[model samples]
Target chain A: MSTVVLLTLTGLGLAALYFLVASGLALVFGLADVLNFAHGLFLSVGAYGTWWASGNLPGAGASGWGFVLAVIFGVVCGTVVAALVELVLIRPLYSRTIEQVLVTVGLSLAGVALLQASWGADPRTYPRPQWTQELTEVAGARVPNDRFLLIGAAVIVLAGLLAFLKFTRIGLVIRAGVEDRSMVTALGIDVRRAFTLVFAIGGAAAALAGALGGVYAGSISPTGGSSLLIFGFIVVVIGGMGSVVGAAYAAVAVGLLQQFVNYTSPGLGDICVVALLAIVLLIRPQGITGKVATS
Target chain B: MLRIEGLSAWHGEAQVLRDVDLFVERGEVVTLCGRNGAGKTTLLRCVMGLHGNQTGAVHLDGDDITARKVHQRARRGLGWVPDDRGAYATLTVAEHLTLPPVVGPAPWSLEQVHEAFPALYTRRASPATKLSGGEQQMLALARVLRMGATVLLCDEPTEGLSPLLVQQVGEILRRAKALGVTVLLVEQNIHFATTVADRHYLLAEGRIVGHFDNTDIHSREADLLAHLGI
Candidate 1:
């Protein structure tokens, strides 16, 4: 009973982090039709930015204010970098799928190399504030205080994203643009600007997730973003390529599956995920909630 | 208030539009009549800045909008309703009705649009893909109206629509004309064109081959039909 409770809670916490990262991936794909492989690069960038920000603070990682500032700065930095990348690199490659794939993949490689050169491939520690270090018993399972905070943050972000999409005119335009780019442009809306904004938002969300996940893991490595990238791709593929809601559901499902498998057959956990993905593809190639291609 | 001078467009290496020159004054309804593959769609695309590989001058309200971007031209009061009745499969009819930012003076409100096309009200919550062909056409026109466009460019507005829907579309175009919206329409339906347009320009093999006013439409109907091979 305790083991189940522990696995469930841990799975849910992992799901929260996955939601933050994968939602952006789904959105960027949905709005821009760009498979941004460098999304993983943004994750590492945020983690490093947070580390630097927290280290610069008065009490370093020990200060609550320092931790908060680091997280905020990390997100902001990610947003700015993503916007620049969109404007300079991705914008010119619109409607060129093969080129986008090549360019973004190359960008990911370059980003990882730059990180290695700058940080010397060391696994650096991320700041965990004192509050997050506290532990409590929840439903007979030992729970880290930060896990609840992560879950809460995930919920808040989801709610905020939903509200933004539902209530705002820009959000409506973005949704419309996602459906028909030419129509949106013919309607006189700047679809390119909308794409840029969506890309930036996706980057910021991934960065925020990376900062939190790094703190949770207690360390961030240069290759840390690569594993999350694979997980992000799995969640998105299982959910749907361009579906934010689908990504959230898939993230939780994958997290739960991984957690349960760890208890049952640890070595086969990765195989189980691949098998499940294969089954989904065999049944619904477009994905669980993806729109069918017209032709 | 829309003019195109020396406009020529190409699709890759094959030239589609051959130096087409046309103009529409404010409150005039002009139709560019042509059969399939006559470059009517390409001409409209050129006007909308969708066809980048083009040599032309498009003047809107005495402004040289030749080099202007699509959205910029749109913001400057150029509204287009393409033949495909451009609507997203995922967006609701209400979203299609409300998403476009209104540009220029005398824009139509959501209520006003719903009033004009009551069929849209029933499908407000439905995705655009779920709407019938006629409803999609109505939504496309409604979208342009909401944008407060001074010059409305419509491509094959009556294409693939039922006769009843065609009549409804004509009514909408007439209403738009009464609102002083200068209409440059690419149409194949002669009866529908005669009903709404003040003048007609016959296009064939990508060039303006004939021009007829409403007064000349009746006498030259047979010639025009023969030219269009109707």
Candidate 2:
């Protein structure tokens, strides 16, 4: 029973991480129609930004309020970078899909290389709050405290996103833009602004994932985001393209399935995920929600 | 008032509109009659800044707006009801009405929209795309009215609608005209056009070939219908 409990909690923690990364990817794709391969770069930036801020920023450190400040700094950095990317790189290409894809692909490759050049390719020990390194007992199973933190954060993000989408004026524009961007512009609303906004939002979420993911893994590396991004993409595909709720559900499914399968058969979890994706696509090509841009 | 002077548009080497000059005065309803591929939609798109491959001077109230973006053109009180109705799958009817920023002085209130389009109010919570074709058309027209558009560029507003719905659309157009909203409409239904429009322009091979008032259209109805291949 304890083993089951541990697996379930651990799976949920992983799911939280996936949700953070995939939510942004889904929104960016849904609203902007940009595949945004450089999303992983934003994740890496957040992880590294938190790492740097912990040691360098005066008000931020590895623990307590200092750590919180560092994460906020990281999120802001990611947001700015994403907004700039949309304005400078993606905006120029506009409706040219092929050019946009190539540019993002190039940016992703160059961004990682630049990070590796600056920070080195080796993994650095991540600065984590002491409480995160501790353990908590749940259902007779000793679970890492970071698992609870991850789950809590994921819940907050999901609720916040839902509320924002439901209540805010900008959120309404985003929902409409995701459905048909040209129509939004035709209605006298500037959709390019919404595009930039979605990019920034996606960046902040991915960066938050990056900062928390470093705590989960106990290390930060240049390639860490790229590796996890594969699963993030899978989660986005399994979920509907632009639905944040769908991404959340798909993340939980993928995380739990990967955890259970990997436990039973060591290296087969990834293969199983691929199989699951294939089955999902075969069954419902539009995804679990069976819609492209719906919330 | 809206005016287009020396407008020429192309679709990758094939010219769709050629030196088309047109204008709609304040509180007037003008219809552009044309066959398929005759650049009627392209002209509307160019005016709305949706089509880029065009060289023209579009003026809204005598101000040159040729360089304006789509949203800018919209902000200038040019409301567009595309042929497809342009409804969003995710947004509800109420959200659709409220999404566009009101740029004009006398935008309709939600209550006014509800009063004008009772059907839309009843389906306010439903997704815009889920509405029936006629309902969608009503929602589309009501959306522009709610935004307080000064000039409406409506493309095929009555297409695929039942006769009853067609009458409803014609009534709405007449009401818009009465409210001092100028309209430039692309329509194939000549009978409906004559009922609502004050004047008409016949477009052929991307050029303005003929101009007529209601009396002229009534006298040449069969010939014009055959010429338009309708």
> CA lDDT of A157 in candidate 2?
91
Candidate 1 regions with alpha-carbon error over 4 angstroms: A63-66, A92-103, A129-140, A143-146, A291-295, B122-126, B226-229
Worst 10 residues of 2 chain A by lDDT: A286-295
lDDT of 2 by residue, A1-295 (tens): 9989999999999999999999999988888888888899899999999999999999999999999999999999989998999999999997899999899889989988998999899999998899997989998999999999999999999988888887899999888877788888988988888888889989999999999999999999888988888999999999988888889999999999999999999989899999999999999887787444445
Candidate with maximal DockQ: 2
CAPRI-style quality class for the chain A–B interface of candidate 2:
medium
User: What C-alpha lDDT does candidate 2 achieve relative to the native structure?
Assistant: 0.91
Measured with C-alpha atoms, the lDDT of residue A245 in candidate 1 is 75
lDDT of 1 by residue, A1-295 (tens): 8778878888888888888888888888877889899898888888888888887745445457768888888888888888888999999999899999998899989988998999878898777888887878877888888788778888887877777776788877766765667778877888888888888888888888888888789999878887888889888888887777777788888888887997798777677878888998899887777841110
Per-candidate TM equals 0.90, 0.94
Computed on C-alphas against the true complex, the DockQ of each candidate is 0.50, 0.72
